[model samples]
Target: MTLDTKKNVFVKLGKFLGQFKEENCIKNEAVFGNDLFFEKFIDLIQLSQSHNGWYTPEQVYFSIQSWADALTEENLSQWLSHYDFSKVKPKKVALILAGNIPLVGFHDFLSVLITGHDVLVKTSSNDQHLLPFLANYLIALESGFENKITFVEGKLEGFDAVIATGSNNTARYFEYYFKDKPSIIRKNRNSIAVLNGNESKEELAVLGEDIFRYFGLGCRNVSKLFVPKGYSFDSFFEAIFEYQDVIHYEKYANNYDYNKAVFLMSNFKLLDNGFLTIKEDSSYGSPITSVFYEYYENLDDLQKRLEDENDQIQCIVSNNLVKNSIKFGTTQKPNLWDYADNIDTISFLSII
Candidate 1:
């Protein structure tokens, strides 16, 4: 199929997704195939929690809405305008998806397909249902996609190249195994925020969204903070108080209780607010329900450190405290052009 045809298929998928709720889903048949697929998708979204405890309706809907916003004609055109795909040959790209959050691997899936390649997807067991179901919708929209997409249950085979997302340990295996193939192998990375003790209350509140959204599971979630020395977190704590309801979720509450006890027993001093904890630590990967914080004395030194440690960091959230920092609360709402790990996926697909 042509690139325009591929874009049209996804735009329809986006419109179908637009019917799903960030708050309440409303059926709209104007979206392609929604007359038959819309209500069923709603059922799947509702049942997603049963499949994975973390895939709550709200989270699933949020993921859906984000994609709905992104897959617009304008967005797709702008994102693709810079890439040259004329030399692309039809090749199969095998995908190993991550399921930490809903549709975490959708971008890679989209990339392979949009670049006019077949996709062999190995859906993470934790997120098996959603993407495949959407694939079915894509097939329904474009019968040609039926041959273009495959979900593999066994060892991936017959793919010209591969894109895989996993933790550091698995990354080593991927590198060794796919070392001969053109590949993009991703490793675990976390997002962090740099606060200058001069942020407005509203900005701090928005930062709370960055921390707690998706229960701090996605790579874009701010798991660590860099605060100026002697900065008082009183206002920050007060601003994030709105997300206190996250404590009611049993999974999160259990984590909060357990991690709190472990920290206290370890004699690590913690700043607590009943639901969230902040501790002084140097690591970027903080545990769920708690965000590690470090005090930075010099902006120049911090910038250099972040530059040096870029591989471990997925995003930086700030009010321009650091170069190319993501705006507060916007980490989860990445544009279609915002390549993960700063790797240009389209360029990789074009070459591979």
Candidate 2:
């Protein structure tokens, strides 16, 4: 019923999740209620791929590890320290989750509940299993959560506010339909990186993680690159060569073959390294197997251009080259305070 109570439940949940691994899963008896839920959670993480091919054990484990790190008492306290939640009045907040990657909609779900609001979640069909499993875990940890969470199977109704994530098209529909309600409606956005050609091989290799993690399915994954003119692709290619194993995944391999064929048929010049393709283009949204690139003439001009088009961008990954840019390999491991779309969900929930 209180914030500390909620935080304790998640901390215990985090401890439970920390036991699952791809190579060896170790059960921690100190974790409460593990007898009933621990093995089942491990089974769900292992079988996630059967529900959606994209949810492979490696990918699902990465997501679980990220959450395990985030739900610590120290991190949760620091994240919540910035906000004043004493004035929050309980309201039902409707959430429409996006399932492009594992746990994509979890931050919103966590924000709504941690701020003392009742959450009405409409889970994406692709991600129906994981969150509900966590919700049940939370309830088992503390029965109070049972009244604070609800999953909708049909039309959503009787909510004071809404937060929805989807494509630009679906966002338009949400904007029109929820015009009368207070809301945060998110649309498609992509991340990019700027390269001055001085990056070390290690830095560039870590950048490959930003590109290839989650099979490049997440909004935080770097989908585009900005390089100075005359930049060579040789070093960049070499740095990411280790991730060539990604091409062995059947789904990613199929996409690689299909998108590469289409590019070749269209006479588009490409820089290929077997597993990933880099194409010079002005667009931010790239296909799953490829990343778009553009050559910038001046850093200042490019900065202004990115500022002008800020709404279309989710994050920028660079070594202090762009304003508010994230460090290499750190985009996917966002802190609790790293609000999506630069919008403060906690502040939004507190006021509503």
Candidate 3:
């Protein structure tokens, strides 16, 4: 099969994805009502809800849309900084898909696709559906992309370079197994927010979107916050309160009861929200049913602390005009430009 230059790959891939999102691509005459073909994400959102997390229907729609858009060659081209792919040679690649959030496999999939390499995906059972669906759609529009990617449900085997995303515990296992291979074995990362006094309530509400979207399960989700000591909790709550309707009271109430009991048994205290529980911890990300936040007395001290822990943070959200920064409203939706690890993926592509 001839490799289409990145230019052609981008355009065709975009067209294919655009076509895929439209309602007509699906054909299930047996069931005429709202279909999971597009709405399959409701299952994901529901699974998340069981753990007391939040996911609006719109958020799920957009999340799937995000996956579709990012997997395309057009998005991949932009991610590679519009580099000409005709210049690179195909590289061998193995990608261990992460099930932590929706479509987390996309980055690795896009990287391999744009680099003109074969991708072998070891899918997580919790999150196996999307990537295979995507490959089939790509096959429909661009057989080359279809043929270039492969999906497997088991452990990954041989490859020149492997990229694995898993919990911090699994990183050591990945390292031990793939030591002979050039690999990017990523450990768990949590995104954080460093709030100053200037951010308005509306912005904070948008920030809530990030925390609630995907139920704070994604690596890009901002879990910890650094609000000014005197910052109004009311302002922060007001902004985030718009999402209150999504509080899945039953699930959250249960978790609240369970965790509260555990805390009581262990002699712990948590500020309550009728459903969600908030506690203080140095760790950024928490389980869907929990949120741990620390109140800092000084900006300089907070900055020093964040700098020390920067390696564990995938993105930093703030409303302040900090370039390359993940601001409040923007955390849930990352553009084509925000590369994981801020690595110049195109530069890597240019090399091979």
Give lDDT per model, in order. Answer: 0.94, 0.94, 0.65
Expressed as tens digits, the lDDT of each residue in 1-352 for candidate 3 is 4445633554444443343332334433443222433354335444543432333334444566665455465555445656666666777688887776656777677667766788888887666665676566456555666657777766665577788888889999999998887677788778777777678887887887777776667878777776666665666766677777555655545665787778668776776655456667777776665667777887667667777776788888875433346667777667776767666554665564
TM-score of 2: 0.99
Q: Write the per-residue lDDT of candidate 1 for residues 12-85, one digit (tens) a residue.
A: 88988888875678887567787778878989999999999999888899999999999999999999999899
TM-score of each: 0.99, 0.99, 0.81
Tens-digit lDDT track of model 2 for 190-274: 9999999999999999999999999999999999999999999899999999999999999999999999999999999999999
RMSD of each: 0.8, 0.8, 5.0
Which scores greater on TM-score, model 2 or model 3? 2
* Least well predicted 10-residue stretch by lDDT in candidate 3: 27-36
